[model samples]
Target chain A: MIIGKVSGAMHSTINHTFYDERKTLVVDKLNPDGSLTGDYLIAIDTVGAGAGETVLVIDEGNSARQIVKEDNAPIRSIIIGIIDEVYVKI
Target chain B: MIIGKVSGAMHSTINHTFYDERKTLVVDKLNPDGSLTGDYLIAIDTVGAGAGETVLVIDEGNSARQIVKEDNAPIRSIIIGIIDEVYVKI
Candidate 1:
């Protein structure tokens, strides 16, 4: 899981079936040191991650298909968890 | 899957539950036409994606368990597929 920040929210009212009842979000990837990397993505949010909160993002096709329980979702990235703390040795 | 670029690699010696025996890679988020978004992440590589290659990342938990066929893996982010093209009608 990658540490990231909720940059914004993406609200759409149409075609994507995967995001039909979900909230899409823009997450800015972050380094372990908390430096902003500027990379951003629109992800489907199941957790209540809000803007500015540090979160854990997941990206896998088969894994993703299993999470949302959809076989034809055009999804790759998802906001799975909110990070409270991270500790690294060395 | 979200469009992204593999920026670097992260190799570790122990302690993580999900990434054991997997090659971890750092991916940079990118826009279409790839202008470099600056966000980066360390993802478990199941595919043979190399550095500088644009790929797709999946982020979800229960789905992750279903994909790798593991129930106790603490994984949320995974390198699922490589993006070849994207056509948005915006």
Candidate 2:
């Protein structure tokens, strides 16, 4: 899992048959210093992460497949947890 | 996998024992219109992906373990493919 700040929510009407109830979000990755790095992604939101919230995103494809119970879900990233706090050595 | 645009790179000194030569990158998630969305990440680069290149990232834990031959690598994101183009309906 990596630390990220939710920038906004992505609204899409289209959905795959496997992931029908999931909502996608646009999130920006953060550096250790809490600065915006650059790697960004459209991740499936399951943990109710909203914009400006620090979240722990998991890109576990296999686990998502197992959770969704689909053999071949195209999911690569998902919001697993919302970070309450972070501690890193400078 | 979700489509994303590689906005920038992330450089980190700290690395686990399992991943030695891998370089970490900071990426920003993007909307389909190419606008900066909020989600971002620190991803392990394996496909020589650079800043400004739209890349495909895989968050496969079990498959990565099989590739790295380690039970626990603590890796969540890795660049699996680079996107040449994206086509989404309006």
In order, the Cα lDDT scores of the candidates are 0.68, 0.64
B64-89 per-residue lDDT for model 1 (tens digits): 46667786455666788887777766
Q: Give the alpha carbon lDDT tens digit for every residue of B43-77 in model 2.
A: 77666777897765555655444444456778766
Which parts of model 1 have CA positions greater than 4 angstroms off? B1-90
lDDT of 1 by residue, A1-90 (tens): 677789888777876565677878889887855687667677777667888987767665554565677778787777666665444222
Return the top candidate by lDDT.
1
Query: How many residue pairs clash in each candidate at the backbone level?
Result: 13, 22
Model 2 stretches astray by more than 4 angstroms: B4-90
Worst 10 residues of 2 chain B by lDDT: B81-90
lDDT (Cα, 0-100) at B59 in candidate 2: 55
Q: What TM-score would candidate 2 get against the native?
A: 0.51
Give the lDDT of residue B63 in candidate 1. Answer: 53
